[model samples]
Target: MPSPAPWLYWALLSALFAALTAIFAKVGVKGVDSDLATLIRTVVVLLPLSAFVWLAGKWSNPTALSSKALIFLGLSGLATGASWICYFRALKLGEASKVAPVDKLSLVLIAFFAVVFLGERPAGREWLGIALISVGVIVMATKR
Candidate 1:
């Protein structure tokens, strides 16, 4: 094939991985502690990510990354860990469909944070997307 169009493949793979993650996590948490389950899931994730890092030869490029970049990466990792903890706990206590939609509201929080901290100037389209996401979350929350 002609290089297998990168963006399309990546989007599809990301969706597949996200869906699989929720289902697998939901099943994995059954009869198991959520925190321990999240830890196990992280271990599973690290295997593939570690292989990709090694294959990309990023281990030798220590100096190329700035301290600011490293700091942001560490912060992002911390946020992701916190999100996973909340998500698993929510899944353990609530319906998967419900928890998933609530977790997705993080996109709204991220967009607002980007504007406040990253000085991001979102265009009209992005603003519209944020509004729609907000409405969806509200609707999901209100449904009995």
Candidate 2:
């Protein structure tokens, strides 16, 4: 059989690291303010990401980018900052297992957003999987 796509491998690795991130953040945010913790986490991520881009010789002049690119990236950055702040707060207040599963609801939302905004048509099986994920998140997040 053919091997899975490189993106799948990288995405699985991301999932593993994300799990660790939630666990570590839960412990790290114990006494710290969630917002402050998010700030520190951002610094840690920024330094390494900056170094990686430079070392990979992929760094480019930001000002040379098209206005459209800049605007989308700026908006994406804002959304990421908000998500991290809220995620940290949730981690600080709830169990990682519960919080993280609830957070996967973003996957369902992504499917909807992609269809609406990106005009992507997912196959029936894929839509079924997304529906199951939505149901799972709702089931896990609600009280019995």
TM-score top scorer: 2
The TM-score values for the models, in the order shown, are 0.84, 0.95
Off by over 4 Å in 2: none
Model 2, global lDDT: 0.94
> In candidate 2, what are the lDDT values of residues 1-144, reduced to their tens digit?
998998999999999999999999999999999999999999999999999999999999999999999999999999999999999999999888788889898999899999999999999999999999988887887745
Positional deviation of 36 in candidate 2, in angstroms?
A: 0.5
Per-residue lDDT of 94 in model 1: 77
Q: State each model's CA lDDT, in order.
A: 0.86, 0.94
Candidate 2 pairs with clashing backbones: none
* Clash pairs detected, candidate 1: none
After superposition, which runs of candidate 1 have C-alpha atoms over 4 Å from their true positions? 1-12, 61-64
Q: How displaced is residue 39 in candidate 2, in Å?
A: 0.3
